[model samples]
Target: MQKQADRVVQILKSKGLRVTPQRFAVYANLLERLDHPTADQILNDLNQDAPTSSQATVYLSLQTLRDAGLVREVLLEQGVCRYDANVEPHHHFRCRCCGKIEDIEWDAFEGLSFRKLRAGLKVDSYEITVNGVCDRCQH
Candidate 1:
């Protein structure tokens, strides 16, 4: 766990961001859990070990991490915002029945392109979220 924390710190430093203990804790927690937690959920978990961690700190840290390209914000139905630590080029599979979000392998969309869909619009990044009942929920 310490090694992972150290690597996170190094990554933050490389991104020219300050390496605060609060930030480290936040990042580590995100790394530990890939369930895509909301800011409130993250704050609640952080307060378990760090009572001094305020909501503002977590929010700021998330924003900073997002700015540094270390995390991504996922918006689900009803405008729920969740934080995802995986910054790779992939999509997500959302289980509507249980609100579970899982990573979709990049190879699923390999060699797929949509640049020709529009003429004058420059496409940046795109996210494809498949929503349905997961296998566990189906069973």
Candidate 2:
């Protein structure tokens, strides 16, 4: 946990972002739980240590982190937005029943190409989310 916190601090510093307690706590929480939690979920978890931490603070912290490219937003069903700390080039797998989100390694689709599919449009980046029953939900 300490290592992860330190890494978060370093990332924030590298991005020229102030390393505040709230931001550290938020980033650390996301690192600890790669489940892709929502802002409310993150706030609920943070309240254990920082009862005064407001939803707006978490939201802002998340926005800053996202802008710094340290975090990515995952939009699942019903316009719900979840935050993911893994910024590496990768995809996602969402459990249909439990709505659990897990990382799908980049290598899984390394050979994929869409140059022909996106002939005219300028492609910046892309993310794919596969929905299915996870292992726990399968059983």
Top candidate by lDDT: 2
Q: What TM-score does model 1 achieve against the real structure?
A: 0.86
Write candidate 1's Cα lDDT for 28-61 as tens digits.
8899897999999999998886488889999999
Q: Which segments of model 1 are wrong by more than 4 Å?
A: 110-116
Report lDDT per candidate: 0.86, 0.87
In model 1, residue pairs whose N, Cα or C atoms come closer than 3 Å (at least 3 residues apart or on different chains), thus clashing, are none
lDDT of 2 by residue, 1-139 (tens): 7777777778778988898988888888898897899999999999976497899999999999898877888887687899998888888999999988889987787677776775688778888888999999888
User: How many residue pairs of model 2 clash at the backbone?
Assistant: 0
Best candidate according to TM-score: 1
TM-score, every prediction: 0.86, 0.85
Q: Distance from true position, residue 106, model 2, in Å? A: 0.9
